[model samples]
Target: MDKIVLKNMAFYGYHGNLESEKSQGQRFFVDVEIKTDLTKPGQTDVLEDSINYVEVYDMVASIMTGESCNLLEHVGALIADSLYQHFQGIIGLSVAVRKPSVPIAGVLDYVEVVTTRGQI
Candidate 1:
């Protein structure tokens, strides 16, 4: 299998358990990895023969910005599910949604939830 990975794609959204978070919003980061057979695209060197990454990016942006979720797990699942449903070539989909500004007591880089779907 081959991978098409989009890392640290950023967006601002309302995604948190706190009331202030929903109103104020914050920056969120997402990482998506799509697994599939890339042999054909590698050989053909044609855009149509491979997954269109721009479309994937746009989809991610839509998911991140369009809706509000309380948990990163739900956000991640939505992305993975959308990818699997919209793209036929994707055999496995993994998504990581990161809340960089989560209101934790101590210092931390970010809090994230990773979700994977499709055949094992």
Candidate 2:
């Protein structure tokens, strides 16, 4: 199976268990991968024969922008569910959501989550 990967898509949003974290907001990174048959797109080389990743980006962006979910796991699962429900041909998908500059005293680059669905 061929894979399409989206890396480090960033967003600033209100998502956290703590009140301060939610009120202040924080940066989040999202990564996604989709498994598919590449032969059709490779043979025809048509945009329609394959997934338009721009749309995928838009979908994730919309999710981040439109709602406030307290858990990155929920956000990650939403992305995977969206892809799976929207595209039947997609054999499977993985989504990761990361939070950077967390409020805790300890230094950390980010907290990340990865969720996978379907056959891949």
Candidate 3:
């Protein structure tokens, strides 16, 4: 199967378990891999034959910017579920939600939660 990869898409969101996090908001980076047969799209070279990148980005942006979730898991799951519902061609997908600013008292890069759905 072929794949459509959207990596390190950034968005500002107020989602976290901490009240400070919710109030202050933070940057969330999402990586999505949509698995599907790209043979038709590759051969035809038509937009309709392939998944629309803009649409997918918008969907991800909406979820990231909308409503607050206590965990990155929920955010990832929401993105995966929404994409599956809107795009029937998606055989499977994996969503990785990254939180750059964690409240932990340690030095680290970031925290990420990944959610996968369907048969990849």
Candidate 4:
């Protein structure tokens, strides 16, 4: 079980339960881990034998740019689903979406939602 981790991919998007949050938008971070067999790629050193992570990043970026969700959970779930569908080689996946400046008045680093699918 090998894994490819994409961490701290940042984006600016409008996603929140509040109308002001949605209209104003905020910086979001996305982290994703993809589990798959890396034996072939490791042995042959061929790009085709392994997943193209650039494509993965592009896919994530596209999703964030194209859609709007009210909750981090929903965004995370959609990312997990889309990754699973787009990459047949992935046996498992996890996606985490973080909203740093949530409108709550309390002092906190960020709010995050994680979504996982397939055989964890």
Q: Which candidate is the best by TM-score?
A: 3
Better candidate number, 2 or 3, judged by lDDT: 3
* Residue ranges of candidate 2 with Cα displaced over 4 Å: none
- Best lDDT among the predictions, by candidate number: 3
Off by over 4 Å in 3: none
Provide TM-scores for the models.
0.94, 0.92, 0.96, 0.95
Judging by lDDT, tell me the better candidate of 1 and 3.
3
lDDT of 3 by residue, 26-120 (tens): 99999999999999989999989988878999999999999999999889989999999998689999999999899999998999999999887
Query: Candidate 4, residues 1-120: lDDT per residue as tens digits?
Result: 899999999998888899987788888999999999999999999998998999999988987766678888888888899889988789999998989998888999999998999876
Which candidate model has the greater lDDT, 2 or 4?
4
State the weakest 10-residue window (summed lDDT) of model 4. Answer: 62-71
Residue-level lDDT tens digits of model 2 in 1-120: 899999999888888788887788878889999998888989998989998899899999988776788788888888899888876579888998988877679988778888999777
- C-alpha RMSD of candidate 1: 1.1
Is 2 or 3 the stronger prediction by TM-score?
3
Candidate 1 residue spans exceeding 4 A from truth? none
51-108: candidate 1 lDDT, tens digit per residue: 8989999999998898788888888888899889988788888898888897889999
Candidate 2 overall lDDT versus native: 0.86
- In angstroms, the error of model 2 at 37 is 0.7
